[model samples]
Target: MPDPHSSDAEPRPAHSAPSSLLSRIKALLRPAPPADREGIRAVLEAAHDHSILDGESYAMISGALEVADKTVADIMVSRSRMDLLDVSLSLTEQMRTIIETGHSRFPVYEGDRDNIIGVLLAKDLLLTLSDHALDIRALIRPPVFIPESKRLNELLHQFRISRNHLAIVIDEHGGICGLVTMEDVLEQIVGDIEDEFDDEDEKTIFRTGDNSWRAMGTTEIEDFNDVFHVQLPDEDYDTLNGWLAAELGHIPRRGEHFQSQGLTFTVVGADGKRARWLHVQRVSGASSSPETHTP
Candidate 1:
């Protein structure tokens, strides 16, 4: 009873067939409902077995681990950079420097600046008369010294075990070269550890060399320029090192030196792609050179 010549009686169109095929393909591609834990584990193992931390995070952890292997020379503020009090000073003079520097502790040195007596607490001084005759031998706490090559983690453990916050880092000859505090170690773990004494406007900076400093990677280009007195012409890069590299057209190396404006930039450390630490000094004047040692 059907009309065979009519289109309605003919086969379906190619376009219509393709639509049906597409729906079937989509259904096949759809994800399977999540299975039981064991089944999921099997699927995960089958898919891939190795995926851990990615690029940036891995670098951060590696850098921190490197801290453990580094000697105190890698991080310690050298004696030249230290703000210390001479024990021979009239008690009034010692108190004055303390108030100016806002330092709670000072390394007491004798006749030769190299000879360290002991660590003195400012609060102890505050309790006594500044004009009173002082005997550093009586008030002194025992000096804590560690080899420059000790691992930071080991040093930290020593700090905890000994209940000591201050330590003098010594060279092979037993000469005092630098000092480290509990706060310095804590900063590595927690990042930019600040105290009530730290200035709000000041950023945490590491002196990378005699003439340069390494700043936090996140620092702004403007802030970097202001801090270092560099006149980097390009507005493109955010860090001083980034600007330097862009200007030089290559990554800088250790002992490689450059200058701009009134500042001298010397590479002290690096991690291939970027400058890790830079030693900066003002060209207008020279400060007394501090003795450096390889631990």
Candidate 2:
């Protein structure tokens, strides 16, 4: 029989020893560097340069960092663009709106959009179709209200804990300002998350003819400038529509044309108030101006 505690016994393998204690000790001894935003950005940029992060991943990391600074108001769908359902509307009417918008959820309002009562999930309507007597109120889940000034990162954490996807943004006066969704928050990080409803081939801005182009209202001003090879001041507003509206001092109606900065902007398609599609034609040999105009 082998003698117990014998020195002659086969030595334990060098690699078999637990290294967690040493690792912990080493970690404790190493000085931790301060992690400021700039430091974090430098690290991320370095990682991107080393091919450890792809372009998309790098952008997302930057966006995540940005989320800490941005408030819900920065990314929320403005009240004007919100597709709200009136609880008083017929079920069929509500269903029609749901189909037209291609949105999965809608804020259910009472008399006005500001007086939001609850949220309506499109899937919840399926059960009510069989029984007309079924209470639509029962289908509405409790709505989540958030302040416009709420930091997006904090909101994301709250969303995770509550398992709620949508939030109604309110102002200091407690009036509904707009609505925010998990998708909206995520888009800030992942760029646009196009779904089946989105047209993959759709162009936000397209050249129509020589020195002429067509742009969607929602097109980003930066993208427009890049495409047109012209500098359009993007300080006050982000979207072409918003810039046009600001210049006009109100939303322009269809057929309204305005010229400024050596370009003619015509509202080719509009929805009574807001310009939906704009036709832009650059004036031949026209000198550009530093100002935006509504004339």
Candidate 3:
């Protein structure tokens, strides 16, 4: 055996990694089940704090618990932003909108946006090109209308049973309010769900509209500042998502917006635990001057 003080000896780890996480959890809850949700969450949190549970596992578990309390209105895409396909439009017009949105599916409307007729899959359009006699209406699948007040847990159950991926949301007066997707519900439990719109490369931000941009939450604050020519404080946070959470006093959620230094920060993509993407736009006549924030 080598001498205990030998400099050439490989240093042993101060301690071995903790035992299997399941065993740790079982030990923590050996006597009985937690009396309530709060009690169960407290135990989970304690384990998380002690490093027995990793951050991703902790976040997902917490998110699953939270979904039961959230409503459709909490995360649905608002009416004004929905990409509705107008049935009256010519094939060219419909194709233009669909390509621009880059969505796999859209809600079909008859006359008004509120009068949603059905759902249309982008892939369904390929047949239209080949069959000149096909009616556009024939391509639509029945639209599912859900009330904005509907609970997310119930909605998720319905989605699974029906195998429908999208639903139109309506207000109490039966007017269109927004839309929801299966991906949206799943996101609450599994973090960001990558889609056709998401770029996995070094391109962290993309121009969405005139003077508006979409950026990943993980984009470096420095990169964002350089792209937009504005100074957002990078002293405290490495990513824009971190700063937004601190600014909002919690993990940023979808559809939440805040105005700061003449720019609007709207969280467009987020799960239950963190912002995945954000839409940032410069307010009209707003100057991109050097700015400072106290928090």
**Winner by TM-score:** 3
Residues 13-46 of candidate 3 have per-residue lDDT tens digits of 6544444666788898887779988988998999
lDDT of 3 at 139: 86
Give the per-residue lDDT digits (tens) of candidate 2, residues 53-169: 999889999999999989998878767667788888778667655654456788998887788889988888776786765556778989999999999999999999999889999
Query: lDDT of each prediction vs. the true structure?
Result: 0.64, 0.79, 0.82
Instruction: Provide TM-scores for the models.
Output: 0.49, 0.58, 0.63
Ranking by TM-score: 3, 2, 1
lDDT tens per residue, model 1, 1-295: 8887887897757799789999999999998864764554454444443445554444455445656766666666576656677877777666555643444677888888788888887767655774477765566687788888888888888899998888888988999888888767765655555444434367645553455454543345687666665555546887767876765667755455666666656554443466555555666653333222121
User: Which residue segments of model 3 deviate by more than 4 Å?
Assistant: 1-32, 129-134, 202-295
